[model samples]
Target: MCGITGFVDFTPASEEREVLIDTMTATMHRRGPDDQRTWLDRHVALGVRRLSVVDLVGGVQPMVAQRPGEPPVTLAYTGEVFNCDELRAELRSHGHTFTTSSDTEVVLASYLQWGAACAERLLGMFAFAVWDGRTDEVHLIRDRFGIYPMYYTEVPGGFVFGSALMALLKHPAVEPVVDTEGLRAIVDFVKAPENGIFAGVKEVRGGTIVRFGRNGLSVTTYWAPPARPHEDDLDTTVGTVRELLEDSVRRQLHSDVPLGVFLSGGLDSSALLALAARHNGGETLRTYSIDFAGHDKNFTPDEVRSTPDYPFVARMVEHLGTDHTRVVVSPEELMDPEVRREVLLARDIPTSLGDLDTSYLLLARRFRQDCTVALGGEGADELFGGYHWFLEDRFVDAQALPWLEFGRQMAGKNGLRNTGLINQDLVESLGSDEAERDLYATEVAKIERLPGESDVDRKIRTVTYLNLTGYLRIILDRKDRIGMAVSLEGRVPFLDHRLVEYVYNVPWAMKSFDGREKSLLRAAVRDLLPPSVLYRKKAGYPPIDDPGYDRALRAMVTELLADGSAPIQPFLDLGTAKSYLADPTSAASREKVNRFSLEMVLYLNEWLATYDARLAI
Candidate 1:
């Protein structure tokens, strides 16, 4: 809900400390534009940019607790801890006085009460840092799901930390190092590796609490979502799930500022809106939706692009009589060179994926005009077997990346270019960790027991774990970043840890049972949503259909190759680049397997150029 930054140098010069804090906080101005604060102790300095979601009038941060001469503990944070009220009551009973009704004080007080262990007890999507005025140490945390990103590095080529990698880059002392391992993971889109993009800037992995004490830095996993442990009956499971999801959505709706829902006409977001509308009763609930302009008729019978969503979205809004706003982005609009440039700046990285790039910024920009926070249907597919890849044959059978086979198919015919970013053959030859492989196999073994069966089911089940751990994480990460960059808070209700735990082992039969994908989910919320929406097939998020857009992207790629000034040229073959770019359908071609895009390549190149990245992995 805000931007947080700080340094744990025990003895830096006063001038440098002030400048560093100012610069770090400046990079996140978009995140917290309303207010910001900074303070210094003998050994530490803290800075924060405030968006003021929870405490609009008060709750200014970099809030300190110094006792006259004592070096005070200073705290700045980013995120919403949903359990603030309950914790506050307990803290008050223990005699802690609160100066404001903000969750910020709760975070600080919780830390004071339970110390570092406070992170485990609190439930929410967050990343925070606490400076121990007494010990000169810094404590940091990322939520259990990595919903909020935090990156850090040590001085020299290190010693910097930030909420966003770009913020970390603002530190004049920080250097961008190519994480060869991270790049390799991205090349194939290895979604689950807990690390980050920039090499030197290591991300505080999700579900972790890190400490920068005198013994140097250390990390411990405070929590891990209960992986599909054994479960109970469907009736009990669905009943408990409905209540947990309701509770999560209700708590996340906490904000002093205006809020709304990003309702897609599908199961997840639609269900969330339905629930919110039901809770609001006669009150008008503002809702927003995005749709493509000229794509082929999808789930709807009409040959209409953006057709299915309007009908279903209209139905949900009318049923609840909520104030709904629909934002349509034409393929041409997103493909505009200016939009691309603006998106890159907003992302603080050189990202090239068209669809993923579109939704977050567009949604955030438009939604922010009305509301600062919005609810989304992000984490549902991974949790409820919504992706076709989660279907039995798709997940458990002799899986050869069912979801990715399309990409691999593209590679065979499209003539993939060498990025030289990595030696793919060699990297794969090196193989995976025996320990890591064992963990993967262990989870897949459980999937092998699902009642419904198919040849590819076993492989698909293996992929289920991979999806939950890898692909889903990557996409969800993008979902968070794109929205946050625009200063609009995006919350995913389906990511409730309780729901994830129960559904994981509910037996694929229960999830995709009745031959319907996400059957269990549909059963749970069948009443809240209209039949059309409740039964509508998932089309993913809004998609694009502009031949012009692809043409524009291809032309840019070709032009970059023609200019020879692109930082990525050396990593790719001129011939391959020309073929891929000139063909026009390279990105759309399945044969273009493991291939890079102008977007991906541009982002990577810009990331390298922006950070002066040393690509020597």
Candidate 2:
């Protein structure tokens, strides 16, 4: 994994523009700490930071590919292309000879052989830019699932894009401004498609290509999971899922450096670890888990997380007999200002689950000490119906995105703290409710219902689509940003396009055939995992449950409130803010609702100050 950033210039390049590109690329140095390179042309300049996962010495970029008497194509790429060897062989047969063993070369060569359609032939989590000198155009492409992020902003001469928003913000022409809709997106959890949250900046939708030329830029969808009728029965679906998972794990294990698994002992991660171990045969695959200090003694069952992860993690670790390390974080570590600031900077957004994200960052940073890549279980929930919303009719049948429904329900229970505290008139003006409805409605409208499908099946398909495109993107982005922040490449075998496509068309009856969550998945991997893990109810990553952490948050928020000149104060209700700050660390104030409010205020303040954001709202 690496970072790619560049811009297509309608105007000629100069020394100043080169400096701007250098600054933009420097912001992503942590993403590609191994090597840094830039390629400049009269109308385009491309930059990349290399983590050196594949073709360590020869895979340098921005790589240029050409043939005799033909204009050259320069490629600035990130992420691994799992099938690059296959693509390379195919290109070789077509008289394209490679000078290097890097997939970066394959990407450039593939484009030379097949044009922009080459993106459809490649498979992996990638965000790349191809400058085709033949046509004097640049093509920006992201993986089908949007596992890699690509943010772009239209500027005076042309457009600028990068793997992260910070890179684009490094450009002098880009503004750190947010409008009403952007603010609503910040507070709300809706993963609006193509929404970048910054004024005039847009994220390239996954599975698509954006081409910039003399006629300006045009977007095209090169790939998407096809909607088709399911012909396979339950037994076949289970077998196929197992087969695809095995293949995905085997393919993803092609890292040159040491790799490990993020094991929580839940069905998803447990199954992935078992498969990875199976691929290794005799070798014990290293595994890692995250836990809170004193969690075993102070653990409390919650609606989302029933039991602590340590027990399940222990069982899996002991059963697998692999080299394992447990990262136990104390409340102090979770609430550390420096840790929180790193998390904020990594996400480049004010996420509601601040502590959990920070913990993941710590875990990732730790993993980097021993491994450059780690396989994580992320896309399984969206594809396998593992979330609570999948089992409940209310959320499944809700007209909005099911997770947003879950969020609202949690907000009602003080799960989303910032709900009523913010400016209601502003929230309403941003059409928070209507925005979610319209987005969900648009996604639902795009679902291609199968012939003779029942209402329940149709509903399941709609929810599945939203989960795959919306919820899964959130998880993927979180993992990418947090993991890449430490220069660790996080691979999701569960997100391999084949697995997602296969499971997406599976009938709802078959998915929940056993009247349990991820029934098909459980059946597929039950042979490898113990019954305890196989039957473990769905549990998300544990949050900071220590009251000491709450107290720390209160102190921080209180300090911010005391600073009347704080950037966020203008948007906050003083009385409400002070009231929450008064005793926000109490046990009664531990709900996600209160915590979200506290975290959001702090994040908003920091974000406004860090970016010097101009909020048009």
Candidate 3:
């Protein structure tokens, strides 16, 4: 894992290029604390901050490959390619000699052997930029599922690209600006594909390749979930899922540094831990979970999260007999202004899930102390039907994104709306409602339907596609950014493209065969987990329910409203915010609605001030 940044400019000065690239690379110090390097030429500059996960001593960047009488091809890469060994063996047979055992070298070799088509052959989570001097072109590629992020924008002579938005923002050519479309994306939860949330900057969509050359920039999608007939019986399909999942987990276990699993005791994480334990040849595996300091006592059941993870976590720990540690975070830590600032910086935008983001950031920080790489269970919920919206009829039949509709319904129960606190005039001016409808239509149109498919089947597939492409992107981004922020690499075995493709085409009836959330997943791993965990209901990532955290948010919002120079004040409805703050309800009693509103106000203010973000609208 690493942080990569660079540019391809026709007009370049060597000294200035080095300084500029160095500055951009420095912003990602947290992503790669092990090593930093820069490579420069007249027309291109490449930089990387290395975490040294695989081939600790041998892997270094920006790595270059050259053949006599030919210009060198330099690669600044991030994320891991699990099929590196296989690709390396194949490349060797083609007379390619390698000096290092690094997957970075294997990626460069793949590019050399297949040119731009190399992205199609890769099987891992990655976003890499390859500068091919031979073709005088730079190719930016992201994994099929976009587990790794890549952002870029066109410059005067060429273009600049990076692993994170901050890297691109640090460049002199880019400005800290958020236009109307960007603002819409922030307020709306449906993340449009390739929307970078900054004017002129575009994210390299997953399963895509962006090539910049003399002719100009071009994008080609190398992969998407292809719709096909499902001919296998229920038993055969279950067996196939198990086989693909096991292969993915085994492939991701190849890491040089200490590795572990993020165990939430939920179906996703527990299943991964079970597989990891089985594959380790009886070697003890380290697992970790996160919880609030007083969660067990203060925890209140809601529609989303019904139970505390600790009980199930304990069961898994004892069942697997694996070494486990639970990181307990206090309300004070979650409410710390400095911690919030770091979370905002890590995300590069304000998120509505306040404590959810902070808790993950804190957990990643602690995880980094012991392990460089940790396997997670992220894509399982989206691939299998795990969310409440997937099971409930009202949500399933909703015309909009099922998750968005579910969010609205949940908030409505508290007499609140997702964006209720925002300025009404601003929302209309930004066309938030229209943008969401358009986005939904655009996404739904992208789903390839099977011939003779029933309306119910098509609707199910549409919802599944939306979740995989839209909601899953948010989950992956959060996991990647938070983990990378602490120099901890998070590997998601469930996100393997092979697994995603196979499961995506399975009929919904078979997916929910047992009439429960994640039925297919539970059936596949039934023997691996205790019934206590395998039968547990779907619970969202835990958030601190302590009133102290809510009190802190109220205090921060109060301070923001009082400050005459606060940037977010212009976009907020102060009267509504002040009324909410003045309400007599106890913080814990009114936690759901109040906490979300206050978090948005506080996070937006911090983001604007820290990033010097100007709202162009």
Candidate 4:
């Protein structure tokens, strides 16, 4: 894992380029604290901060490879290539020699052999920039599922790219500006594909390659979930899922540094822990879970999260007999201003998820104390129909994004408004409702329906596609930002493209054969896990429900409203904001609605001030 940034400009002097690249790279020091390196030429400069996961001693960047009489090719890479050994063996047979066992070297060698088509052959989470001195072109590639992040924008003479938005924002050519479209996406939480939420910057779409040369720029999607008929029976499909999942977990276990599993005791995570334990031979695998200081005793069941994770976590720990640690965090920690600032910086954008994002950041920080790489279960829910909304008929039939609709309904039931406290005039001008409808229609049109498919199957397929491409992307981005912020590499075995493709085509009926969430996943590992975990109902990551957290958020909102110079003040609906603040115990201040609204205001305030972001609305 690493943080990579660079620029291709014909104008900057080499010394000036180096200084700029260094500054951009330094912005991601938390991502790669192990080593930092820079490579420069007259027209381009590349920088990387390395975490040293695979080949600690030999994997260094920016790594350059050259053949006699051929232009040298340099790679500033991040994320691991799980199929490195296989690719290495194949490359070696083609007369490629290597001095190191690093996957970084394998990637460069593959690029040398296949040119731009090399991205299609890689099988891991990655976003990298390869400067082919041969053609003076740079190719930026992201994994099929976009488990890692890459952002870029065009410059005067050429372009600039980085592993994170913060890195790109540090470059002099980029500005912290959000246009109407960007603001709409942020406020409505309708993330358009490739929209970076910054005016000029664009996120490299997953499964695509962006090539920049003297001919300007081009993008080609090398991978997508292809529409295909499933011929396998229920038993065969179940067996295939198990095989693919096991292989993915095995490949990801090749890290050189200490690794662990994020165990939520839910089926998805418990399944991963079971597999990792089985593959550990005789060693005791390390597993970690996060909990609030008194959440277990004070736990309140909500519409989404029902049952605390600690009880299930304890069951898994004892069942697996692994070294498990439950990191308890206090509401004070969750409400800390400094911690909130760190979370905002890590995300490089404002979020309304509040403690959900902060808790993960804090967990990742603690995980980094003992592990460099940790396997997580992120894509399983999207792939296997695990969310509560997936089972509800109303959400399944909704024309809008199901999760967004669910959030709206949930908030409405609490006598509160979803997306509350934003300036009503700004929301109307952005046409957020129409924009969401258009976005939904655009995405739905892209789904390739099977010939003669049933109407029910078609609707389910569309919902699955939307969740995989939209909701899953947000989840993966959160996981990457928080984990990388602490220099901890998170590997999602469930997101292996091979697994995603296979399961994507599986009929929904078979996916929920047992009439349960993640039914397929549960059956695939039924024998590996205890029934207590394998049959457990779907539960989300626990939220901080302590009343103290709510008080802190209300206090912050009060302060923001009083401050005359607050940047977010212009965008706030003062009447609505003050109404919620007026009575903390009112229905308007219910934990779910109040936390979300307050979080948006607080996070947006911090982001606007810290990034000097000008709202061009």
Model 3 TM-score (2 dp): 0.97
Q: Give the poorly placed runs of model 4, Cα more than 4 Å off.
A: 12-15, 412-418, 587-593
Query: lDDT score, residue 262, model 3?
Result: 94
Q: All models: lDDT?
A: 0.68, 0.84, 0.87, 0.87
Question: Residue 384, candidate 4: how far off, in angstroms?
Answer: 0.4
- Candidate 1 versus truth, CA RMSD in Å, comes to 4.5
Poorest 10 consecutive residues by lDDT, candidate 1: 412-421
Off by over 4 Å in 2: 411-414, 583-593
| lDDT tens digits, residue span 454-554, model 2 | 88888888888888888888888889988988899999998888888889888889999999899999999979999999999989988877878877877
- Every model's TM-score: 0.87, 0.97, 0.97, 0.97
- Write down the TM-score for model 1: 0.87
Total colliding residue pairs, candidate 3: 0
**What lDDT tens digits, residue by residue, belong to model 4 across residues 1-617?**
99999998866574567789899999889889999899987688899999988878999899999889988799999989999888999999999999999999999999999987899999998999999988989999998888889999997888999988888888877999999889877767777878999998899988899999888999999887778899999999999999999999989888889999999989999999898887877789888999998786778887777788988999999998988878899988988888888899899999888899889888888888899999999999998999866888898898998788877777422222435787888878988788889999999998887998877778788888888878888899899888887889999999998998899899889998988888899989999988888888888888887777878888888999999999888888898788778875676556334667778888888999999999988
Residue runs of model 3 more than 4 Å from their true location after superposition: 12-14, 412-418, 584-593
- Could you tell me the C-alpha RMSD of candidate 2 in Å? 1.8
Q: State the TM-score for model 2.
A: 0.97
- Candidate 2 structure lDDT: 0.84
